[model samples]
Target: MTRSELLNDLEQSLTRLVDGMLVDKGRSIEFLTRLDRLDDIAIDMARGINADARLAGFFADNTPWLLDEDLTTAQKGRAGTLFAEITDLLAARTDEEGLKLGREAEEWSRAMGGRPLRLVLRATREEASLSDRFHALLRREAEEVNMLLAEREHLMTCLDDVLSSAELKRDRMHHHLAASLIYFLKMEGYKVEPYVRRLRRITEILEKEKPC
Candidate 1:
């Protein structure tokens, strides 16, 4: 395939990847919110009970009406199922395992910041470098990507702080983390569009040039 055709294909693939990531991110936020809400309800229900048995007995004695009161019928059903799944997950995981998973998630979010554009540029570096204007444009795009990466890193750090804090309630922590992720994605996604446009421009210029 021609260089322009290759870049166009790559851009389309990356766009699809970005869309998928956004959808996954939305679902992840929803999952975390549900878990946090359940945790809050469990904590409330466990009041005056022994600390160790609280989580274990959360859904044991009787299903709490609190969930029904607070959630829609569909949400209540989903929450019940999710609670069971979370119980199984907690049973299977040690504190260390849980911490490791949290760290992995944070690392994955950090790594995702500028990866799509970086991969595209790396794949087409030779053709992009052929024209000084295109090369300079790529540099500018890289700088913009870095700026977005820095912003996302800062937001992610704020999210980590919220997650790590003992003072914040589960509900507050969930809101903060969800807002931070959505904001980070919004700002980061904005950067991708411009970079994609610049890439298309570079490809168009390359297409117009005769082979040496």
Candidate 2:
């Protein structure tokens, strides 16, 4: 594959894997394994790009930044790459398989600009506390949702102690984007009661976990 083509494939794979994590717990292992396979040296040499090194940079970045309209075309690609890199690093931990989850995430990001949904609070990108706060508040809530899903899925898969710190961080990001997206729609007065209910269930689940 050409360099650009390889990059495109990488993006799609990363996007898919990340997307899978957000929506489908059953398939997460498959996505992660794909990510690990793509980490191979032969693939990089064939494409003339060091996939491992390129993906390493992704681990240090945040997923929401990928959606910032202010990012240059190049910057968006970099952010996407970083997002994928992080996914790859994370997926390496378990039943091991991994890509293709990005389109839905992008759609939600566009929802910020009133795409398919009105905005009560439009999310804008700037280097400021307000920008950070918008995502931060929703992200914390999102993390709760992720924890619930992760726990339930772990029970279903019977996978134990498979998560690393890096894995948890990646998991948080996926939940944030998904939760923040729903919260954004809620801000618009959209019909997000289902999401709100699903999110609130996290609290009840946690309550059950506390020492009695």
- TM-scores of the candidates are 0.29, 0.25
Clashes of each: 0, 17
- What lDDT tens digits, residue by residue, belong to model 1 across residues 6-80? 999999999999999897567545544544555565334323222234443433432343323433333333344
Which regions of candidate 2 are displaced past 4 Å? 1-80, 83-170, 203-212
Rate residue 59 of model 2 by lDDT.
31
| Predicted model with the maximum lDDT | 1
Best by TM-score: 1
